[model samples]
Target: MTIHRAHIAGAALASALSMTSSANAQALEYQNTSGGSVTVYGQLNFGYLNFDDGESTTDEIVDNDNSPSRVGMALVQPFGDNQLRFRFETALGLRSSSGISQTEVPDGIDWDRTNIRHFDFAWANPNYGTISLGQGSMATDGVTGADDSGTDVISNVSVSDIAGSFAFRDSTGALTGVELSDAFSTFDGGRRGRIRWDSPEVANFTFSVAHGTEILDEDADTDYTDLAVRYGNDFGDFNVNAALGARRIQPSGSDDEDYVIGSVAVHHAPTGLSFAVAAGSEDGGGDYYYAKLGYARDFFAVGTTAFSIDYYEGDDINGAGTSSDSVGFSVVQSLDSANSEIFATYREYSYSDGTATSYQDANATMIGARWKF
Candidate 1:
């Protein structure tokens, strides 16, 4: 297995693209005067999502709700036992949403495009490990996650993906008048502008650390530090992966806060059975719990067919005594021949306030297809 000490999604897409020698989707590779080469690769994925606010529902196309749709390039140069690498990547919002709008596009311009997602440099030595800098994931990013469920491409209990576009109905069946806030979970902390380091694995254990600032406002008087430890091993037919991480944020004009998160997942390859659990808490007044169980089988000629159920509960978000509960189920079918997948999911979300009064609830259903090149 190839070890990816960089961005998780990047590594996955790169691996998928590397297997295809198709003339239509070929990666541009160049050999430099030095012992080095550069490769350009990317993937595009989109889905149609329908969200219900109890009284009404709307459907729209969205991008990266599951597997992100992006394009990127990488440069690698070998120096004896060590290597130097650089990567540049950006995402496509695809659909017009609050986060990205097409209305402002200049006439004659088909697309205005989004900003770069990943721009980083790294140095790696098999014996000494790797160090990276720039806009990318922190060491603790995804460290609180342990989902072996194939449905992750469609649903993983992260409510924000679909909930953002719809409103939630209060207990009395009244609209909150605002878009439902994204689901809360410890499975957050995506990419950021940071410096990170990964230590070589020893006895199936590896360590990582990072310091970074929020992506949008780097100059904000806020700074964050993240640290994590990871474990992976195979015992007979059982494969296990576990991670623990902690983060401290010193926010501008606010009291400092810290958080701890951990997760473990186990899978039986021969039987196609898997399970995972995760929990986390913040120093102030917030906590979350998540669990998922699933199975995968080669029921189709194309690839494996998988299904899973996931649950999440979060409390006192940002010290507001706001709580959320979400339950989701999904089915995913992979088409190996085309390097793509078809998935469908159903989710129910509930929210409450500090007084234990029901705040809102909503439902979402999505059907989508994704392809990686």
Candidate 2:
């Protein structure tokens, strides 16, 4: 077996253009690069950005020229019998902190030591099974994350306007500045760990199920658990996947927050990608959802290099009665493995009420080259 120390999802990087590669779920891939015990590759991003809050009074240059460059490095190590038999991946990166107040945390330009971005390990074999440990995505989900929202895609706010986008909340009047607590948002960083199993493929179809555990309570000795089932397959021309996920945040808690999320996607060869989305109410609060339409294609050479473009849309969150809808776009290309490429992004956030403009409206535009290895 073999092992490597590198996290997946490099697609989250701001600007690097290439057909996304699949993480080796069954083997080690770093050995394909230099043919040694370890392999390394990363993105060194330099961006030139202009952010405007609809009014010129709030325009600011965000990155690249004078902005602190973002850098990351990852190493992969593989060992054991089956190659996929044993492996470890870890990544270290530098991040600039930003929040409601720049002074809430530190002054500016700092590297975090106590914070961990990525740390996880997995073991699997066709004959046996697979188990993962540490902080990672829930076993019941796919890559429906914000990064894969494609390009220029909006937030889930607008989707709230859909037929069933609103939920039960006491948010009648426009409330700004006074943010919603973790109860309203899905990003509460609670305790999370996952376990799952996959049945070998029959034809092009595979069946999978996963269960996740979260320490929702320490004082009461209770935790959250989520269960999910998925069906996936690929035809000659396209690949299709669907999943049903449900989370029981805390069975013993008073709120008993439980929600369900279902996703389906069909990606055709060199271009089209389509996805269906549905989110159910937690503890029978209500329901909301969204659908996405997108396509990707490569283009002509400009000044001796190739360029590409990607576009997507659709966002809904907070239901139709509350605020939280946004649409955004980003275009990135490589200037060279060690250089940069041009980039520009835009997003129009709309809300059920006038509060949408304050919480989501903004457009970002930029042009410059980036560098990395």
Candidate 3:
């Protein structure tokens, strides 16, 4: 199958390129300085492209290859007599991320900087709440959906878009696309500048709400809104977290616009087990769900191998008219956090009533070093 070959190819590619080493960067030498401060951190991942879903997300490479990886910096400074604060994070490596198209997918895209990997500023102690601004993911973005589907736009679903997906379609089948939740992608406020609030939690439960105004070119558009509630706790050997989230777009009009997502996760670490369930509504009018179960233990008590499994499905697309499911597993090994091995994942999808079907899986083996200051 196409999906199977893609996985194997990507794996072979990753295996060949996985031979990597990076000199350790000195740690952030904090002098306990008084005024405002700046901090930075990022990672670079280069590997073979062995994925067989017959759907190469970015580019269809023949075998093992080298590629650009993630790199970013965070900056913070105080202004306005300590009343105002600004922070911005940007990147050149995100082209390989899940939210947007990378040069990796065959004959893929080329993006320029200032695409705003992320930017936000906060003025604290405001009347309604902390006034903030940015094009980053809003409060409900991760709370209600699959937050880190490989931390890449091509692999994850965007919670803000009415379309709610990054996977794209080619003449033969479906291929993954950039996060697509970006400012220019679609739907007002789908991904835009906004401010939000945090109602101090009571009885261990918290509340948050945020709204954005889509910048349709320099003209701007109607307000986009997101609202949600969250709850979590750990008692004895049991731990739990749950979130109920939703988003409504172009509040000014009620045409074909709407999306919803819900999620719950639990862990029983004593037994090395965990589970998660997430569901969403993208139908402009329908619904869907994704789930996972995982277990971990030292393979033969050597601390060299670990494993997990994940399953996913989406239905009643935010208005796209499609539905599908995916299941995956991963193996990992570590000699301390700096040096580790990761082998992951398989996902397959069946379209509406067998009208269409596509499969995708990833096999990545990497050995790298990381040092933080």
Clashes of each: 0, 42, 47
Q: Higher-TM-score candidate among 2 and 3?
A: 3
The stretch of ten residues in a row with the least summed lDDT in candidate 2 is: 159-168
Sorted on TM-score, highest at the top, how do the candidates line up?
A: 1, 3, 2
Candidate 1 — worst ten consecutive residues by lDDT sum? 100-109
Order by lDDT, highest first: 1, 3, 2
Candidate 2 lDDT over 231-304, as tens digits, reads: 66778877776666666665454666666666666667545444444344445454444454545445534322
Off by over 4 Å in 2: 1-37, 45-51, 54-109, 113-115, 141-175, 178-199, 202-224, 229-232, 251-254, 270-281, 302-320, 334-342, 352-373
TM for every model, in the order presented, reads: 0.84, 0.58, 0.64
lDDT tens digits, residue span 114-181, model 3: 34545667665523345567765565756643232221211222222112223434446556442223
Task: Report how far residue 22 has shifted in candidate 1, in Å.
Answer: 8.9
Error of 1 at 122 (Å): 0.3
Say which prediction, candidate 2 or candidate 3, comes out ahead on lDDT. Answer: 3
* TM-score quality measure for candidate 1: 0.84
